[model samples]
Target: MDEDNWDKLDEEEDEEEGDFSEPETTTSTEPTSNDYMAGAILANGIIWLWLQSLQMFSGFTSRISPSILADFTAVTIVIAGFISSQQVAKRSERNQLIVALRSALYSWAGSLFMMLTSPNASITFSLILLVCLLAGGVLGSYMLIQMRINERKRKLQASS
Candidate 1:
């Protein structure tokens, strides 16, 4: 460009640069996994509490027998697994399937606790829940393996 145009452009650039905001600096650089886990747990707890409040308002729990409650508990555990999966997804796609599977295992353990506490609940139903839990775990593990394989291929391509 002409000398005058170049000078005008440089002046405009300097003016714009002077108007820019300064970047903030902090000491903490990385977020902890516990932070994500805490958020997930808090969200799930709030949802469960809401469900309980609904049950109270409708008198559903009182109308239903302990058997129904047991079933509801099982379903709640499954829902928790789903929430955990979502939390993992939010954190990162890598190893997400594995994290979700581990969460499913945690759900199974929670349901097992309820089953053990209830005297009238059948062992058979608990076994069925366990089977479903294991199935989800297996599927999650398979996905995790696939993710690992893809990651390896990516690394190989980058290196080559």
Candidate 2:
């Protein structure tokens, strides 16, 4: 309130302003739907390339039974979907469901494109893989959102 105090405070502020250390880290950019779509395409490519390599190099032809292969592919798709949803949920606080669906839709399109291009796997299996992806994305996002909401509610109640 006095001139002496005001001058001291101004000097302190000046000293603090000159004390720069390291550069601050910027906030991470949010993941977009295109990222998810690109991820799906990349995953499909990896799967296709890996299978082709096995058949060509390791003699993994019809040795891999259709049922077992299809099952494995379906499981992989579900896990990818779940992981994608988890990433989306972690980065975003709202629009989790919408984002998940949009990502899943793009992922399904990628799968369809892969099947059309290669036609190595069965058509029925592709359909099953698409369903698994959509289901996993939706269910995984829902579960994470619910858990976070419940946790917030509990924290608020405890503090109250």
Candidate 3:
């Protein structure tokens, strides 16, 4: 009887040790609604700051060739969209394309705000910026997600 009790105690100790063994690592990229909202807010803030700076340096912009400025602005918008939406699609490696598209659309609301408020924006320029933002957001997010190097391996996040 004593030997049986001792054996059971040993087994319990082994079970406890096994249960507490090294934490397993898994990718916890499942994005939440807050992630999307955060992306949108980040995008809006970036556009707002960019617009403010452009207004402050209106003279500099005016001196530059309009075509050059337009192209530069398009590129900037795309980059902004990409960066802003990155957080939203960081964990969506399997569905990066769709996530990227949705993230871009959500973040593009800020750009839309800029378009509506711009006193002198031409239709051509606005359309160009729109397309650029779409391309940037989707392309950037997809690339980041597809690249295994950028994947977030979480061991503790799930515990918390």
Task: Choose 1 or 2, whichever is better by TM-score.
Answer: 2
Q: Which digits, one per residue and each the tens of the lDDT, describe model 2 over residues 1-160? A: 6999999999999888878656776576456666776656654665466556656754564677778866776676677777665565566667778767666777777877777767466777677767877876787689889889899999999999
In the range 45-94, model 1's lDDT, one tens digit per residue, is 64357456756766656776778766666565455555554444444435
lDDT of 2 at 51: 58
Which runs of model 3 end up more than 4 angstroms from their true locations?
Answer: 1-28, 113-126, 149-160
lDDT of 3 by residue, 1-160 (tens): 9999999999999999999999987677767667777887787677667767778999888899978866776777787778866667776746766777777777766556767877876777656656776797777776786564433444345556
What are the RMSDs of all candidates, in order?
A: 9.6, 7.1, 9.8
TM-score of each: 0.41, 0.59, 0.64
For lDDT, candidate 1 versus 3, the one ahead is 3
Model 2, backbone clash pairs (residues 3+ apart or across chains), number: 0
Q: Could you tell me the C-alpha RMSD of candidate 1 in Å?
A: 9.6
Greater-lDDT candidate between 1 and 2:
2
Q: For model 3, what is the alpha-carbon lDDT of residue 43?
A: 70
Global CA lDDT computed for model 2:
0.71
lDDT (Cα, 0-100) at 94 in candidate 2: 76
